[model samples]
Target: MAVTSNKQGAAMQLCMALPENFRRQDFLAFHRRDADQLSEHVTEDSLLKGVVWQGQPACLSLFFTERNVSVTLDADTAWSADGQRTLEAWVGHMLGLTQPVAHFEQRFAADPVVGSLLQRQAGLRVPQSASAFEAVAWAIIGQQISVSVAIAVRRKLIQHASLLHASGLYCHPDAQTVAGMDEEQLKALGFSRSKAVALLGVARNEELVALLAQPVATAEQAEAVSSRLLAVKGIGPWTVSYALLRGFGWLDGSLHGDVAVRRNLQQLLQRPEKLSDKETAEWLRAFSPWRALMAAHLWAQQSSAGY
Candidate 1:
């Protein structure tokens, strides 16, 4: 085994507020990796193997490949000059940099579970937005299954429909690709009867994206979006919450159906039973718009555990 960081790129300013060109060789077992393929597919022609972290674009260690794995950021347009700089700058922008960083400090300071996970712990990386299609698809795949299997299925989806190189950099598939998938093709790829149907149903529905882009100014706006999202077949509360936090950037809600999360908390408190949705909800209500980050931290704990 070997470690290398010898790639040459432009000398752009790395935001002091974010992570850059980093990868934990042990990250895979730590959080079990995002088996559902959370990398951003922001365009039809490009596949973003990175994510929007603190509004900055960040990627895994893949400097040797030809098809750059960097997400472009900081430019006026969606496209970036270098995937590295663009991704970083853009992610920082999405994180609402204008708001005082103190806002986050204050929020985390007020909550022990979330704040402790951030300040005192390591191994978690949160994204700015979740791919709506990916989250719902993941929720459907993981409805009654183990996290490992769900990740396997998602890996197949990416290999079949996404772009990647031998170097291990993968580009997430956009909704349009999923929306246009032929029925037989997906079935052949292991999409269960119900998940396949539900995935296509939501994919073809243009209204989902339209509504997601609206101004979520009030509780009513958030509630309306949540309700409409849940109405879709194969999409339920856990799925909806994942989408809101990962896709829509509404990070205050906790993911209910994640087996790993239940396990982590159970292990932490030495609880007698797995957490029920009601208990999970009560626990998360205090986070108020940062549940996504909270979830990320829990997942990271599992990651660091060598699970």
Candidate 2:
């Protein structure tokens, strides 16, 4: 990573090379789902978002070139070289640059179901959250609600709990911030009592927080994390799976319970109706260790079906 700075220590830019077959349009479209521009700002050519660095707010501006993505961090204070490397690593993780999509493609290119998606979507990868806290909290907030409503409620939560950066963007709150929030405060932001409790429960629990922060590098580790998360109140299979996918970039999460995944799968198979969650789970078993990637493909398939 080559680093460049123009504002002395207050700003720095690092360029990361994009892999061959990287799906730029799909990645940008995924980021565009933040319609309200609360946590992230996305344009046709670039993305601007905020992050918390060493207990301070910072802005990340990402500009894509033909071969590389340039990430520029702007902050009020200077950070050590190690701190800067940490931020660069976080940005790479969030952008899905570290995911092994190539290996997935190599393994599934001849399979049914998702094989065409591998060919069509090419280098599609899972975009992770800045932190595990954001992923789990988002999954809880989205439970039993439409995506649009969930996005709106998430914006509300960020507005209420996040810190404002010098660049006028709100950084998503960390676990400690959310844990410190009162249930009534979240309720006032349109979260149901149950969701408020659930979000707080995950955030406040020390064991859960530590587990969330753990590096999930293997299937066994991922499963252990899922088991622990499911034991928490207000978290279910769907929530645990979703959190694992978004937070840890664990690719095997079975999202058969997701309505859109089932509906899109029906369309993919030309079935008369969406499969039941059980049937969907059974069908997805063939794609073990890559089911979440299949889900992402299904989502992309659904998003482009209108045209």
* TM-score of every candidate relative to the true structure: 0.64, 0.92
Model 1, 207-291: lDDT tens per residue?
Answer: 8756764545456776887887777776777777776655555656677456776677666656888888677667656665666
Off by over 4 Å in 2: 1-7, 76-78, 304-307
Candidate 2 C-alpha lDDT tens digits along 46-86: 88887776568888898988778888888777667676577
What C-alpha lDDT, on a 0 to 100 scale, does residue 76 get in candidate 2?
73
Please give the lDDT score for candidate 1. 0.53
Best by TM-score: 2
Residue 250, model 1, lDDT: 62
**What's the distance in Å from true for residue 200, model 2?**
0.4
In model 2, state the lDDT of residue 245: 85
For candidate 1, the 10 contiguous residues with the lowest summed lDDT are 1-10
- After superposition on all CA atoms, how large is the RMSD of candidate 2? 2.6
